[model samples]
Target: MKNLILLHGALGHSSNFEPYESFLSQHFNVHKVLFHGHGGSEIPAAGLSIELYVEQLQQYLEQQELNDIYVFGYSMGGYVAMCHALQYPGKITSILTLATKLNWTIEGAAKEVKMLEPELIESKVPRYAAQLMTLHGENHWKQLLPAIATLMTRLAVKPLLTQTQYESLNLPVQMMVGDKDAMVSIDETLFATKNIPNANFAVLPDTKHPIEMARPELLIGLMKDFWKI
Candidate 1:
């Protein structure tokens, strides 16, 4: 059986995959990573970039002496996982991404950054702000808030993944999405699949951008199939 590492999206913590971890554990040994600056973990003042995040994960895998692992990432985490596979080929046996797309264009990413700027400037006390803050204590939040905004702005300036870059990865990849996913359109995802040498795509019926709310069973089934366990 392959060891598995699970990564969550922006504003999400390790607990985001709690609902499905037990199910996946039956098939693979699972370890969930809490993104840097997230879940109350120590973070650099500069916060995180996709590149930094992948390095952190790579170090973790190396320290643990874990290889031949499977990676399952959701949203932003999915992007990081994809990059890792490209940078460190043959290390990851298979990759599964949920509700994520590889076509992160500079124009589109900038628009996303524009949207988040207002939210960051609004104030840390807002309920929406709380959603991004997983750890307790105001000290950690105070330290992490600025980093998050800065990182968001940085991402806006540069697209994390591009079609040409994604085509470079030859790993087996499976993308699981929801039919009602408003964040990423199926058409956009299809464009990404065009160049991937070994890729599988699945859409859950009556689902939305947030897979948690749609149907967990569908995701679980896909995981089982992908892992063949």
Candidate 2:
């Protein structure tokens, strides 16, 4: 059986993959990873950059003595997974991403924030604060804005991958985005998959950026099939 390493989106813990855990366990050994600062893991708040996250993932894999695993990442987790595959092409067998964003342009930033606003506005302040706490603990509310700001403002340092980088990947790569994903454009997702030499791109109908609620089974099935577990 294949070993599947699952990654969750920002501010989300490994439990986010709870629904698929049992099903995936039946087919493959599953490890639902908890990113630093989430799930009571000891990681700093400010060092939550993409590179840091990638390093943490590598360490985790080493500690667990894992190899030849398939990776399934959602949203921000997807970004990490893509970078991982790019950096360590030989380690990954197959990669699958759901609602992953590739490039970040000036216009893309506007659209990204615009899409997030509605969720922030409609959300209950305390509930949202609690969710932040889940990821950042006691200083959740106070640190939320700064953390988000850092993600937006500091993103320029991390340039988007070129077409050559994506096509250079030797393993199969698959990306899925919800048709109704307000946070990321379908065109953006399409553009990402296009350059990948061994890539399959799919759109889930009536789905959203936070696809946890829309179609968990579809996500699970895609991973299982792609990994052939």
Candidate 3:
């Protein structure tokens, strides 16, 4: 059986993949990876960049001798996946990304960082705020916010993945975005698919960001089709 590695988005942990475990495990060896400073793994106070996350993932694959596998990355994790594919060709069998932003610029990134406002989340989305706090330590969630903002700010200056790089990656890649995803634009998602050599794009209707929670069935269907399981 082929191995299926699930990479969670920023501010999320391996637990985010629990919903897909049972279903995907029946078809392949499903593995959920927690990026550095996420889940119960060692937390880096300064947080991690996409490159660092790629290195950690590479080491994990090496330790398990998982040279070839399917990598499904969500949001930030997807950016990491593209970097990994570019750096280590022939190592990844395929890549699937959902709700991953493909465009970045310093000004745009800085504006996005504003949404990470602490008071806003704690006030508007208290449930999510509570979850973040639980995922991180009691008050460590706030610390993670600034670190994430810093990474985004840096990405604006230098993105982890670029159009030229995406066009050069020979491996198959499938990117999906929700129809109502306000965070990531459909145009950019389509742009990525068009640049990649063997890539496909899907727009999930009646869905929004976080497809895992918005429409898990559609996500599973896409995976089944992509992997042909």
Candidate 4:
């Protein structure tokens, strides 16, 4: 079986991919990565950043002796996966990204960052706050929010991948977004797909921003079709 890595989004735990893992494991040697500061993992002293995550991913790949791996990344994880492919070409055979935000601008990031405020989340969406605490660890979830906000701010300032860089990618890529996704726009996803020489784009119907809201059967079917497995 081919190796497959499932990457979760920011503030997301590896366990979030559990719904899809069991089915995917039958076809591939599935692996789920938990970035630092997530899922009870220790936060780096320098905090969470795209560069850090990519480096960690490289280490994971090396340690596991994985080669020509296939990746399915959700949201921020998708961005990191692309960066990893760019930084270390040929390591990943192909990629499938869902709801991954491609256009990072100062204005847009600021708007998104506003929604990540811990205080606001606790006050306005206590249930979500509690869920995050449970997912990331009761004590660590608060710190993770700010760290992720900083990461987003930095990404807006200096995006890891450029249009030209996207065009230069050698591996096949499939960019996908939910029709109802509020965070990532279809326009941006299409733009990325057009730039990448060997890339395609798709929009899931009735899908929302949250992975938990995604239709697992639909996503699994799409993955199998895209990966041809």
Candidate 5:
């Protein structure tokens, strides 16, 4: 059986996989990747980029001597998975991504960037703000917000997974999103799959963004059904 690697969304940690850990481990060696600026790893000043996450993943694999793995990524993590699989092919057997917004137009970036407003986070959503501070540290979380904002701007200009790049993938790629997810449109995912030679697309019923937090088992079931494992 191939080892399973779970990649969490931005502003999230490896613990995000806690709910699915036991069940997933029963079938495959489960590895949770805590990207740079996350977990115990040192935060980089270069900010958040697919390159940063991919480098961390590559290091983890090299350190563990791992190969023939299955990758499951959420949101930003999902984007990272596609980038990684494309950049370094042989090690990854398959990839499954959820809520990974495909199209990154400048307009889309502006809307999402506003949500990272430090003032809003500190005032209206204090609890959420405190959690981030605790998880990422006061100074680092402050730095992280802007870094991610910059990353969004960068992605708008150059998406990590482009049509030409995705079409080149030789491995199975499954892209899914919640039907109710306002952040990512079904059309974008459908369009992405069209160019991906070995890709498939799906929209989960009665679900929303952060499906891992809402219905992780549904994701697991989808994985099993698609992989036919």
Candidate 6:
């Protein structure tokens, strides 16, 4: 079986991939990574950043002694996976990213950061806030919100990956976005796909930004097809 690593989105934990793990394991050796400050992991002293997550991933790969691995990343995880591939070439054989926001602008990031307010989320989206608390810790979840906001703000100023870098990727890459995904635009995904020499793009119908809401059959089918397993 091939080795496959599943990476969750921002504010998400390794457990979020549980739903698909069993099915994926039947075809590949499935592994999950929890970024710093997520899934009950202690926040690094330097806090959350794309560079930190990429380094964490590199450490995980080295510790496991894994190579030529396949990666499936969702949202922010997708962004981190690409960065890791760029930093450590030949480690990842291929990458599949879903609903990842590729185009980050100051205005766009500011809007996203504003939504990370703990109080506002607690007041307006109590269920989501409660989910965050459950995923992280009851007390620590609030701290994570600000840290993630800072990360987004930094991305707006300087993204980890540039157009030339995308073009330089030597491995196969597939970028997928849901047609109904409001957070990630299809245009941006397509643009990135076009830049990559060996890349493909796909759009899922009746899909949204949240991975939990995605139809399992459709997602798994795409993965199987991509991997030819």
* Better structure of 3 and 5 per TM-score: 3
- What TM-score does candidate 3 get on C-alpha atoms? 0.94
Worst 10 residues of 4 by lDDT: 39-48
Residue-by-residue lDDT tens digits, candidate 3, 128-229 = 889888887677778777778888888888886778898888998999988999889999999989999899999989888864556678788988899888
Put down candidate 1 lDDT per residue, 1-229, tens digits, no spaces. Answer: 6689999876567787878887888878888888888877788755688888889889989988898899989987888898888888888888898888555556665555554543453474466556554442445665555565566566656766677766887888887777888777788677666667788888788888764675677787887787776
Q: Would you estimate the TM-scores of all the predictions? A: 0.85, 0.85, 0.94, 0.98, 0.92, 0.98
Name the candidate, 3 or 4, with the larger lDDT value. 4
Q: 1-229, model 2: which lDDT tens digit per residue?
A: 7778998877667877888888888977888777765654554746466777788788888998888788888887888887887887688788888887677766665555443442463374666566656555665434444454456544544554657778787888888989998777888788878888888998888898764565777776776677665
Q: lDDT per prediction?
A: 0.75, 0.73, 0.84, 0.92, 0.83, 0.91
> Model 2 — TM-score against the truth?
0.85
In TM-score terms, candidate 4 sits at 0.98
Model 4: how large is the Cα RMSD against the reference?
A: 0.9
Give the least accurate 10-residue stretch of model 5, judged by summed lDDT: 38-47
- Write one digit per residue (lDDT tens) for candidate 5, span 1-229: 6788999887777887788788788878999888777643566767778888888898999998888888889888888888888888887888898889879989999898889987889999998888788777776776777778888888998877778887888889898988998898899888888998988888898888864445867777887887786
lDDT of 2: 0.73
Task: Estimate the overall C-alpha local distance difference test score of candidate 6.
Answer: 0.91
Worst 10 residues of 1 by lDDT: 113-122
Q: Top model by lDDT, which number?
A: 4
Using TM-score as the measure, name the better of candidate 2 and candidate 4: 4
Q: Residue-wise lDDT of candidate 4 within 1-229, one digit each (tens)?
A: 7999989999998888988888889988998899898987787889789999999999999999998699999999999999999999999999999999989999999998899988899999999999999998887898898899999999999988789989888999999999999999999899999999999888999999999999999898899889887
